[model samples]
Target: MPTAISASVAPQTGAEPRSPGPVSHPAQGKTTEAGGGNPSGIYSAILSRNFPIIGVKEKTFEQLHKKCLEKKVLYLDPEFPPDETSLFYSQKFPIQFVWKRPPEICENPRFIIGGANRTDICQGDLGDCWFLAAIACLTLNERLLFRVIPHDQSFTENYAGIFHFQFWRYGDWVDVVIDDCLPTYNNQLVFTKSNHRNEFWSALLEKAYAKLHGSYEALKGGNTTEAMEDFTGGVTEFFEIKDAPRDMYKIMRKAIERGSLMGCSIDTIVPVQYETRMACGLVRGHAYSVTGLEEALFKGEKVKLVRLRNPWGQVEWNGSWSDGWKDWSFVDKDERARLQHQVTEDGEFWMSYEDFIFHFTKLEICNLTADALESDKLQTWTVSVNEGRWVRGCSAGGCRNFPDTFWTNPQYRLKLLEEDDDPDDSEVICSFLVALMQKNRRKDRKLGANLFTIGFAIYEVPKEMHGNKQHLQKDFFLYNASKARSKTYINMREVSQRFRLPPSEYVIVPSTYEPHQEGEFILRVFSEKRNLSEEAENTISVDRPVPQPGNTNWESEEQQQFRNIFKQIAGDEMEICADELKNVLNTLVKKDQDLKMQGFTLESCRSMIALMDTDGSGRLNLQEFHHLWKKIKAWQKIFKCYDTNHSGTINSYEMRNAVNDAGFHLNSQLYDIITMRYADKHMNIDFDSFICCFVRLEGMFRAFHAFDKDGDGVIKLNVLEWLQLTMYA
Candidate 1:
């Protein structure tokens, strides 16, 4: 459940008041509620009012209910224990109780039980007579019966609970709990008002009918017909009886004992004795259980006893033992054909156990149980499990988990070394190493011991300059480590092995050693451990000292030209808009001019740009351009002079002239400019360079073109003199 809640605390001073901020509360199904007056608040109010019982909003309830009402039937297979005899007996009983009379006259009427209604009871067409009979028995115990039926709440995670069902099979009872609900009329496990009641009922009946035969339509017709349909697994018909034989109760008991219903036909011998006068005639009748045969003392005396009814219920037997029977007066009927009741030739009759078995097509015992068992027809079973221990190691080859092959594996061993105290410097080294490892992993490669041979250097300075110092350190490591690691992997094995120093060796150096420049520290990696070999004796120092005045300012004309060219190419490719182009060119041109004045050549600029293009794409994208630009920004204000005509970009001609003025040959100047400018294979300038060049050239062209008024590309002496005076003024 997702819910939102606010985390803000009330202000202590009680100054006027601040607006409530968003609050996030977990649970309640990711629901968010706003304070006072927000969309969520309003929704919450509406939900609280309309669907109080559901715990969810009215809209949500509506949606869920709508889904439940759709036509769908859920079939479940429950595993019934093989030992459940009592349940088996209970399942033998008939599902329908047929009465000769309508429901109103019956002393006790059968009603739907467990599920929502009789119409909802669906029997999967399996030969599980026991399960079906159990279902019928459960109907007698409605509430207790329903308790075993799984409900929707049972499926919910937090509020779920198990329910048990018991069934009597043979003589004993068996019980089982199921996880899900019995399907409703709509075939869903839940009920809703919108479901079609008639359809549900029809579906249930169809289910039962299908179990008897292959189809449900065959079971339709009359009461006895329906009962017989179920009994013989076919369709059947039933008739009403006005009266029955005197021994109905005895016959009923006997039939119950014998475990089957009896069938017969009836006929009237004489109809005058009937209390309710009506036509009496021969008719077929069915009965169950025979009490005793009435043996008269006299040889010719009429014999009569008792018989019971199996209501698929009817009024009574309309033959010899019927209420209108004249035979009570001892009248003789040699004409057995005239009897009120006639035995159906193939109709059922009570018989001794032996005869019952011989005559009836089928017989089954009905057993009742105190509990019911799960009726799911499907069952699932489980199979197997296994377990153990493992050890792991690291090496250039790869890490491996070992079970049997352990000690001899060099790949799994760890190497350790002691180093002098330099906590900050060590931290920097460790961080750099971690970063390198990450890069290796990203490339789906192993961080081999040899790869660690690459050298690293960390420098520290005063806290006041920490930010700048850290930036420089990061930039240097990122640029150099990437190249060096690749080189180490491809070249020196011994150097790589020695480079695999432990993280602790990179410890920060103490400020005490260099107290005046307190907090200053530096970390350096050796190609080999000290005192290891002759070559290892040589120490190469790459110092990242605090920037000071005397170091060679690498920002020379060549370097500046290289950087400017890369910047133009990178910026153009980046497609930076007009205003940005102006700023970038202004900055780069100014730096280039300054570097030129300082005697830096175009070669130096080219070298710097080459260093910056990490991917070796020969051109810099915006990120690389900006990085290179920052490095040269401090050297000169070349941007001002580059925008000669007061526009933003320097065109080829303008660029050539600018470099020439700075003492660069045309070819060298062009080389610097083109190399710095990002372009496609066709050599077309990119958007960033184009905009910058366009603006810068526009200005330069305006100044120069104005002087060459004749449009001959040359400025006469008079024009130059006039232009100088006007520009000066």
Candidate 2:
């Protein structure tokens, strides 16, 4: 018997749950729950807020699709404004939204003209070759294709301006609803189109997918496997043909037999003279779908063959074994008939297995997973996908290249419970496809960021490690991450790597190429055997019990002097408003020769008062003053911790430690400026100067952190540029 595990684990939690065990939602089709204690390890992030379902309608395809038909209108997500949501899409791209029924667009439009086939698809003006290629592969397997595009409704039956498509998002399969109102320019299709004038299923499917991703611009460019996986809840593995396994042909053949959608691409290099097709008749940098694989007997000898179709519906490879090639004449008349050899202008053509291996640079195979619960005859895979963010000073640790911060990024605990029988190897092993893809980079391209160089590292916990120790430690990754169970450090939008490991617990960390480069990512784990996944829920103990301000023993002599200064400004009332705070600042800057306020406006005084006004009384009492002073004292302690000297001053070198200790991780340029601002005659920062500097520094840090809207360590370049020009100037 195989070990069974649930696909969706509970969301991450802060404290340990009352019952330290898996909470099962059996109706969700999860078979087994994770054995749980306290969430001391990766279980911490099981319930993180990163994942957001579009809505909780929980409707079947019949119910949702019928709802649109009843309304006699196309489906429009009330939550998202059709025109203003995505910058690259509806807004900047200038889409003329029009929802017309099949008959409205064409004199006699059909949902699908004849039966759907690879030849039906044609590339339009959009740069979505990857998606069209996947659609072509879908045509080969009607069962899988119909599964994605439900077969219930047609143009004649439910003639509403609405359509729906299903996609596997992260851990769940979701139905995306969209209106038939597509972007058109002067009554012509702007993006993907079909070869048949009356056909609309291919175009409608593209619109539904665009709506699912927030906009049409989002579907501009992507790898085939992403779309193929969405079309079929299949496990996809990509291979660079040059580095493929020894039994690559055998693997491709077996995959084709088991109903796999495959795609391949030539090296993306096009000569300037050849805009579309090269001299060899193959389109440069274009994706082609692998429609069929065959082993035929030619001239009494066995020969392997591959059938490929270009999404453009023209410009095919004019090589050996191509249409009307000399190789076809070697076949007997009966053999040619058996091979179903029909030569036409359609993009599809047959090529020898050898020629295919030589021409294509990359291959992707998406295996249609079998349902293990329904039948024990086939192997069922357990899949878990989690969404995470790489926030700077928090989770934005880079790859193992930056050892100091790399381990600080998110880590998932993968508990492989069972191993498969391997006849070639002595050890029972489990196979895992660790797939990582960064999200939203394509959407942010107009904003000056592209797909970040991304990858993941997987470390196996030693057999002897027990309990919480099963999580890989930071030091363990310092030198030998290369020794990890699986790690692919590369610069690509998505990367999939396979590994065979003995049944054990392991930690997987996905990160970008450089530290602090921020992006959202989805990490998917597919295992041949059932496995459990959880994230470490790390809670920072920042809110420690506060000491009473009345306790004089806690106050140093300098703190007492500061309190006296406050009392003098407040005139024995021991309370100060924004006006009094301004007066106090003016008096102090006048009295202290070292202090300077270059642009200290009344707004600064009000901002400081707002920061310390815990009770929001528009004023700060003695207790509030003490509370605020203690925070300043905390910053002083951090400065002194790095000072390491009783000289009452520290040099520029120590400022880095002070800033980091204070939890404000500024870049090198900002750190230098802040450090130099407070420097004394010898470029040393005195205790008095440190207090003034950090008080303002705290405000600046809080403001800078606000610009990180996604909580990703990265700030928008335009925003940063605006800040640099306005704030300092």
Candidate 3:
């Protein structure tokens, strides 16, 4: 299998939060019309590179639900693993395959056990506690659960022994279909299970997700936010408990009120070691879902409380506010009734705010931007996403310490129109989130590439520095660490930093942690206002003259003779290679007086060869060679313009003027770097050095132009291509 490398950069924090416009749903069936030709559509959100807008659509659960009913067959995925070991299940646990609907399994099996409550999910043998925790948190909202697992699905109504579930993969919703076949040991589920034996939603949902990724093994270990995003088409921001925002408590309260799903995990990561119950009653390295947050009066004093669930359906925290702890005794019956307090071994437990913070090390909150409730619909934030890549020899110039070519990588220019409308605040604020994610690492963990350290730099583009400036000046980031507005540089799979910036145009440069490392990335930009659009650089294309057509009447006798000689030496071929061109040059040098006087040597002939081979094939066809011949003639004019003394070389002081005349813009530092690399021992640029410098400049020019797909002289990337990564496959 070919190894794949990819990444995503999403800048999310921005100006004052504003109410977004009404969300639009794509017209069904016509895949091309989804998102309405707008790449920034919210539900159909996928900005991509290379793929067309129509490529994002997939069969909806409703569509597949109807199809399975008509076909009268269970949805047996052709690629489903044949047996247990095929999906890497442990040999000690022999799994017996069973294909049956809910009625056959039990007297009254439910598609959704107990109204999609958190207690309905119970983790079994699988190590996918992170995913189960996400599901538990997702159960908090009935509207949200119905949106994820369509209400139309049930064993009796649409029972063909097939079920379909929808997940937001990258920028679009994808339907995954699976049969009711499950792994059973001793006639019971061997993996994820629910409290009631008749409840099978958790098992079936897990199976659908497993099939979506490749197998159950592929879903073994991962972050909860990844699963939450898939279930809710939400934007997630991860926070470390130690460095959480000052307003974190308020953020958590608002998140729960907004129906956002959250999960937390302890610090330790001991592989394959499962502790049925820790000494503190909180399992280390195990993920727990946050179900509720509230502040209420208890015994004439106000106390903050948080509710959490351990997917195992049994373990409870032994500290204060725990299930049977003494803290509950202090609360009177009325207050207990008001808070809906309960003490049970159903895995759900309450903890004080202080204890919650101290015990959990990391938290993941999925913002649920796409599927926000109708009440919060107007509060949705519009997101603009851009996708990019870092090829080793091309854009992967890496970090800034490599001064020479760091500026050559792709750069995005974002224009912030307005600051947050905070009436009392004197400081202007711009909030945006920057998420840098490595692609395909999760899917091909065993056989494919691993994650790489990645981050991005944001620089302010002064108002005067508008139009035609493709990149920041060489010294723009050199003077101080404060030059770039971003708070700090972090290397992680996906770092979503929310930043505030006064109204200004900013440049974002995404890169690998080290210099010259290659990977592909997607950069997403979100703000309160829709004023954000990439600034396109207008570059002047080189206009080298083409050779006059043959058989023209207005040709001098000498010119006609030379043209005839050129055709005769070239024969049937349209152009010539280096060796063939050398032969032609040799013939011209012997016959032409001007060539003899100029003293052009074989080194010059080789420089010309290096100049014309654009495809790097070391061969030039007719059109390529003609462009080279005309460009060489043009360079001779530039050489004479700078070499006023009529010497064979131009002075070092005059090289910049000569290059600029040839249409290449080099900053002072790049100018110094290039001259040092190519200048002779005498520090003088001979005709050879001059042509070589021009060739290098031309290559840069072409590299920048390659990204301007529509000939609009600007770089635009698709956001969907970056988010999907390997998730789409």
| Every model's TM-score | 0.17, 0.69, 0.69
* Model 3 lDDT per residue over 1-729, tens place: 111122111111000011121211000000000001111222232211122111114544445556767987665445564465335532334445654445666787767644666776777766677778778877766555655565556776767666666676665666666767777655777678878888788888888788776667666655666677677767677676778888888998888767778887665433233333567798765668887787867778888988888777888898977878886778877877766678789888888988988877677777766445535544566576666666543355566756544665567777777777678878987666655555555555446444555667777776788544555544666653422432333333354667777778778877665555656666667676654755223244554346776863525664455456667766777556656776665565356333213444555555566556666666666557656655766776788776667666775545655666787755434555665666665556776567667765665456446656687767654787434321211
What lDDT score is found at residue 245 in candidate 3?
82
Per-model lDDT = 0.26, 0.62, 0.61
Per-model root-mean-square deviation over C-alphas: 35.5, 13.7, 12.6
lDDT of 2: 0.62
Query: CA lDDT of 27 in candidate 2?
Result: 8
Task: Give the 10-residue window scoring lowest on summed lDDT in candidate 2.
Answer: 24-33
lDDT, candidate 1, 303-421, per-residue tens: 43433222111233344445444453553444232332344321112222322222222121221111221222312111011110111110011111111111111110111233324
| Per-residue lDDT over 1-729 for candidate 2, one digit per residue giving the tens place of the 0 to 100 score | 111111111111000001122221100000000121222333222222122334325554456567877876665555334444531433454455543445666776777766677766777776677777888877666555655565444677766655666666655666666556555556666666778877888888887777676666666656677677777766667676878888898998877666677887665322232125666687645667887677778878888888887777887778876886877888877767766777887788888888888876678787766631223454666787777777554456677767766766777778888887678878888887778877766446547565666677777766665335222445777754442432344444566678887788888888776766767888878887888877643321112245766645535766667667888888877889878877765554454443332323565566566666666577888777776656755765676575665566776545655665666544434544564476764556766566656667655455456677886666665877676523532
Best by lDDT, which number? 2
